[model samples]
Target: MAGISGLKVIVKKNKMKIVVLISILVLSVSCRNKEIKSVEKIDTSKETEEIISENKSKPDTSYTTDIPHIEDFQNEVMKEEDILFNGRLKKYFTLSEFETVFGQNDSIKLLLEEEPCYTIFENKDGSVDPEDKYLYKEGSRFENSKDKVAVDEFKFTKSNFVLFKGIRLDSSTSISDLQKIFPNATKNIGSMDVYKEGKVQVIQLREDENNVSDGHINIFIKNGKLYSMHWWYPC
Candidate 1:
């Protein structure tokens, strides 16, 4: 009877050992699965960071908010009809041509001593006087070089001289009127002393981003009325 009890005890011990071994195997598998999950999580985070870095390295190509180029502004806002002066825009004219437009050569005053030498075609009419309304060939010694030149600029102090599409220096013209006429025109606010009050606006065309050329117009409005205008173009 005692021998049979010992055999039963040994069998019970063996069964407990088998259960412990199986538990250990299951725990090992669970730990390995947890390690693999941790590695996968790290890889996913790394991939996400890489994607974000790549996106940051790429250049932004959106120009929707950028100011339009000068040429584009002219084409879109101030069309050819709006800028025609005496049926022509900023064209170089020979002395004969200028004479034909203004009158005989003797009537036109050629200012040789002035810097950036220009010519004057004073209106005998009292409305727009004194300020000879045209720039001679810019950067040329007018006394020496008889080269062909044109009216590179026009200074308008009176309301009678129409600048663009019947727009002139008059009480009827206002900042709002200019804004309507040139929707894309840029303001020279807080830059030049003349524009400190945010009243002067600059209209430029044919000037590139690098400022390779000089072609622009300045309109000054005071007390909500168009005060004066200056139109300029490269020779």
Candidate 2:
């Protein structure tokens, strides 16, 4: 009976050892699987980072061809007859010539001041005179209110004028389009860039240069659209 009891104890010990061995084997396989999954996750994360880096390094080629080189505008001469003021292709006009085309019967108001040197012609209602709303320097002469008075500067608060190249100086003009039109324009003065062609100057404003006023051309722009244009003659 004693020998039989001893044999049973030995069998129990062997069964316990087998159970521990099986548990160890299962634990080893679990650890290996976890390690492989961790490696795969790290590789995936690295690949994702690499893709993002490559995308960020890529150059933006969308607007490259749209904006022409500044050199393209160098030595470019626009015809004087192409500059339009109220459909009149004349950079500067005499008061007589203006009345001749619009007829002498038109009602226009002329405000002549000598202190600051300005001669303004507006509508009878004190609004923008599309036919003739110009500001000139002092000493500008007009014989009988119908004589020639070289326009020093003009304003287009209500008139629609286009450049020789069909570039409209209205509220619909864009800064980019303006840059393309006058590639030689200066960087920016306040909210607008000034382009000069002899006695004429074209001023364009960005969204930022609209608030400050200095009596120059007040170009109004909203949401990248030119809404209004003011032309101040270059002194």
Tell me the tens digit of each residue's lDDT in model 1 across 1-235. Answer: 9999999999999999999999999999999999999999999999999999999999877746777565654422333345544344334556566545544332234342243322323234422233332333321111212545444433333322345665543446676776666555534222234523453544443333444445554555556565444444543
Per-candidate Cα lDDT values, in order, are: 0.49, 0.49
Q: Please report the candidate that would top TM-score against the real structure.
A: 1
Cα lDDT tens digits, model 2, 6-66, are 9999999999999999999999999999999999999999999999999889987776666
TM-score of each: 0.37, 0.34
Per-structure clash totals for the candidates: 1, 4
**Stretches of candidate 1 above 4 Å error?**
1-82, 86-173, 180-186, 189-217, 220-228, 231-235
- lDDT against true structure, model 2: 0.49
After TM-score superposition, the amount by which residue 71's alpha carbon in candidate 2 deviates from its true location, in angstroms, is 8.4
- Pairing residues by index, what is the TM-score of model 1? 0.37
Candidate 2 structure, TM-score to reference:
0.34
